[model samples]
Target: MPLIDKIAWLHLHDGRILSTRSRGKDAYYLPGGKREPGETDADTLLREIREELTVTLDPASLQLRGVFTAPAHGHAPDVLVQMTLYAATYTGQLQPAAEIEEIVWLSYRHRPQVSAVDQLIFDWLRELGELAE
Candidate 1:
């Protein structure tokens, strides 16, 4: 099986979480991306958030939430993604950039519209009282 590593930001406000949909994709996902060569997790997340959401993440504020492994979203069954999650504050307004089509505020009820891994995350967040049920 091929292993794909990625990062996701857990940005929450009130009872909602920030999610994004790629320009030509069908499912919603937490805003983040893959790591570049020679980059640390903090470096990857900061750069990815800037590129995809037009916001700069404060590296010092990053908190490692969890590491999740799942069948890669939109990929073949043999592919799996190991996603590292971090929580941090960002500066600048969020805009859909690069391949992103839209930025959405998702509540627990919106789980069905997101990817399988995102659904697991949403459930986890809800159980942790970080999200509204």
Candidate 2:
């Protein structure tokens, strides 16, 4: 099985997590992207967040939340996505940038509107009493 390795930021505020929808995409996703060549997890997180949300993540404040794996959305059934989740502090206002079309705060109730991996994340967050219904 092929695996899509990606990093994601878990920015929860008021019991809702920040999520993004890219232009022409139907499902929302967490605000990070794949690791570039020679880039560390922190590097990927910072770069992706800045590109998608226009915020500079505070490197010293990055915290490993968890790693999650699920079927890769919109891909072949045999493909999987491995998401490395992080919680961090950031600077600047969060605005949709680059390919991002919308930014929203999603609670557990919004699970159905997100990607498959994000649904797993919602379950995990809900179980931990971190995500609101």
Candidate 3:
């Protein structure tokens, strides 16, 4: 199966997680992107977050939350995406950049508006009592 290796920064504050929506896209997603060639996970995450959200992540504080494998969103069956999530404290205000059109702080109640993989993450967060309903 072809895998899309992506990273997501989970920023939890006040019972909400930082989420975003691409321009003209309805599904919400965590702010991050695919890994670049010859890039480490930390490097990819920092680059993606900075490019997409204008924030810098602390490399030393990065924490691997989970590795999620699911069917590629809006793609044909048998196609899968492998998402590796990292939660870390970031320093800087978040602003939508690059392909991101809207920045959203999402609680678990808004879970349905997110992608399949994001929903899975939200469920996991809920199970851990990290997300508010």
Candidate 4:
């Protein structure tokens, strides 16, 4: 199976994580996307978040949380996504832009509303007791 390499920002606030739903999309995803050629995870995350959420991430605060792999949502059955997750501090107000349709704060209870890979993230957060509703 082919793997879609991606990076994601894990912004947690008051036990909830930030999520984004793009225009016409049914599932929410962590606020980040595919890495451009030769881009580092931090590079991809900073760029994607700026494009989708109109915020600039603080590079000094970037931390590696985890890397996860799961079947890619909305793709062929065997296609996979490998996501490098980061916890980072960002500057500027978060406003939906580019392809984002909505910005939502999600808890473990909101798992069903997210993609397969994101569901895994919710599970991880719940295991750490950081996703209480």
Cα deviation at 96, candidate 2, in Å, is 0.3
lDDT string, candidate 1, 1-133, tens digits: 9998899999999989999999889899999999999999999999999999999999999999998877888899999888899999989999999999999999999998988778889989999998886
Order of quality (TM-score): 2, 4, 1, 3
Lowest lDDT 10-residue stretch of candidate 1: 114-123
- Model 4, range 9-93, lDDT digits (tens) per residue? 9999999999999998899999899999999888899999999999999999999999999999999999999989999998999
Candidate 2 Cα RMSD (Å): 0.5
User: What lDDT tens digits, residue by residue, belong to model 2 across residues 34-130?
Assistant: 9999999999999999988989999999999999999998999999999999999999999999999999999898999999999999999999999
Give the TM-score of each candidate.
0.96, 0.98, 0.96, 0.98
Q: Using TM-score as the measure, name the better of candidate 3 and candidate 4.
A: 4
Candidate 1 at 99: error in angstroms?
A: 0.9
Q: Which stretches of candidate 3 lie over 4 Å from their true place?
A: none
In model 2, state the lDDT of residue 31.
Answer: 88
lDDT, candidate 2, at 58: 100
Top candidate on lDDT is 2
lDDT of 3: 0.90
Better of 1 and 4 by lDDT: 4
